[model samples]
Target: MFLPFSRYLAFALLSIHETVCTELGTSPFNLRPFSINLSSGVRTMLNKIKTTELPHFPEYPGVGSSFGIDLNTLKSLRKEWLTSFDWGKEQDSMNQFNHFEATIEDLTIHFIHEKSSDPDAIPLLLLHGWPGSFLEFLPVIDQLVQTATTSLGKSISFDVIVPSLPGFVFSSPPPANWTVHDTARVFNTLMTDVLGYSTFAVHGTDFGVGPGYALYDEFNKTTRAAHFVFLPFYPLKPDALQALNITLSPLEKFEEQEFIQWDSSGSGYFLEQSTKPNTLGLALYDTPVGQLAWIGEKFISWSDPHAGTGGSVLDSNEILRSVSLYYLTRSFISSLYIYAQNPHGFATEYTKAHTNAPMLFSAFKYNVAFWPPALAEKVGNLVLYRNHESGGHFPGLENPSALIEDLREIGTYWTT
Candidate 1:
């Protein structure tokens, strides 16, 4: 009787241990010596989560027509990547900018911490969004530094910090229940604690937009100001706006149209990212061609369709370079995990939070999303709402001179 009871207890403990390890993306059947001692009680609480399967890209009639790049050309380009691309060369190019990492709370954040040789440089934080790394802003750094020098004076250059967002490239994934706000806090530490800057200006677009504001909130007293290419659709709760007697103007009506378009057309990536990133990550992780196509679809839509915007909206060379970073680092899944396990209600919470600081917005016309000047004013101060005749999401990359000039003008108003 004693032997049978002991065997039953051992089996129960093994089951529990397996459950716990599987839940956390680890294998439980390791033959390692360390597996022998875990208490049955500790393992019982763990639940296994099944990773979902990603979807197939359905062949569409006009998909290739969007970029004017024929199927044959794309096929050949992909072949070249498999045969000729050098990730080592690309890695070296990325390292050309100074690199630094800082641990804040639960994260080890990787960033390009480029301090201008000019001693009087202003500290500027540049944040990148999903599918973007520090390299996204590389093409335009010179222009930005120049703008800072000219507007803030030669003595006033900019020390720029561009971090890989949590779950992106070099940064680690979020802790158990972390949200974008949590990511923002880490960034604040980087700014205030690590870099030792009491005040700095900030800029971001896409998923990076929200954190940019959080940085402003974190540095409420001293952060000079914040700027974003993508602005949140405010008054998060539809019912609340009705209760508050909020009203939007004619321009607001037009901006709403753009917002609706974004939701309808620009949201496929959002849906997949927020709900099933892990599943998609599997495909991206295993096949480089699949990863390129996954990212290539977005590159076409976001950049000028004609490729006129910053070298074909994205060059074949650049896509491979970007994808290579994901592949070599083996970060595709971990990075995508940020979207999968993002804190459940952070976006809603952020948009609806009660903050009295008036907002300043610059809405570009061709951006995938933007608030019409009228709607933005209704939401906040909307200090600068200018429509560009050209340029899209990657404004700085697409039209550097125009973006620099605009930033210079916007700088004068905010810096004072």
Candidate 2:
């Protein structure tokens, strides 16, 4: 369990020289301070997984519904999409950026590595979460690149890297018992060893929030800082009014109130996934509509109904496409496994596997239902904290510009 610090630095440097800089397009100002090769033991451990296709989870009847929206809405959305939305056109638009895959812990991890036109542009590791994909950040990435190039200058572009979580879309499944922490380590290897980033800022949204924090914990040892759309720890403050600042507008508040009242509420998915993920995942993997509905519910429920309510946010179509990645990868099960394996209240036997390094945390007002910012600060040595009037669960997709700005600020002040 004791990952040698020496090995860790070596893996990072190996990434910096052989993979990160050359691949990413610039060398850090100084690497003489760090080693750049993996220790033999670390190399042996890293080589353990033999890459292979995941077992073909046979599709089952009613399984497709697992991804599609509720039957009634699914019908309407399907009509709209079939008659209007264009995948071929969309594919070309996405191809404007770079995409690559590298073997990490036996899985072929997929990522979009868009180096900014800016040579001095900061390297950023952007992660997407469950029921989502790398595509979630595409809109934000586009804006960041444009802003950096036009406003900041050509050398101000982001050397951005967005990766699909293992077992989700493009990326291969976890061969055996991979957890979020393990995934974080794999990403560490990817960013440092495969991509050659000696230091980089990490950002994530949704479930990506957890691994993002984990990666920051890992990367902060040699890199800069970490930012997340969702922070898990919740702290109760004295002011009831302060905590009552819900993201819902008057109409939306009525909708959510009705939702909480009528629907069986409060993250039933979390309960199921945390307890019996495989059983539910079996059904979700087969029922695309079911999967879509499950994910769609979160999209509609999580974001601001009117985009302007908070920082500019993702519209409905963008959310759906992000969900589609999970379906295409048939990763509903593997992704849910992170929940089942969560060690939050579990014994040290499982918990001691990873480090809980101090993090620079931000809890968007909308994301507080799960991990309120005041509560999050209690868990770690919180170095940075902020509360936004807007921004819901999926911040990257919701308010990319604001998220990017916050990230740039964190990089400027904390990366040193």
Would you estimate the TM-scores of all the predictions? 0.71, 0.69
Model 2 CA lDDT for position 198 = 79
Q: What's model 1's lDDT at 388?
A: 61
Global CA lDDT computed for model 2: 0.57
Per-residue lDDT over 1-416 for candidate 2, one digit per residue giving the tens place of the 0 to 100 score: 23235334433444455455545665432222211121232222212211212224424436443442345555554444445544445555555555556766567777776665555666778887666677777767755543343223332446778888887766777865667778888888877877667767777666676677676655556446666655433322224424666343453344334334323454667677789888898876655455655777777666655553445646656654555456545577887776766645112121211333335555454552434444444444455655555666667767766676666554334444
Could you tell me which 10 consecutive residues in candidate 2 have the lowest summed lDDT?
A: 345-354
Model 1 misplaced regions, further than 4 Å:
1-76, 83-86, 147-156, 234-259, 308-313, 342-360, 378-381, 414-416
Clashes of 1: 3
Q: Which stretches of model 2 miss by more than 4 angstroms?
A: 1-71, 146-157, 234-264, 307-313, 343-360, 368-374, 379-384, 414-416
RMSD of 2: 11.9
The digit string of per-residue lDDT tens for model 1 on 183-204 reads 7777887777666677777777
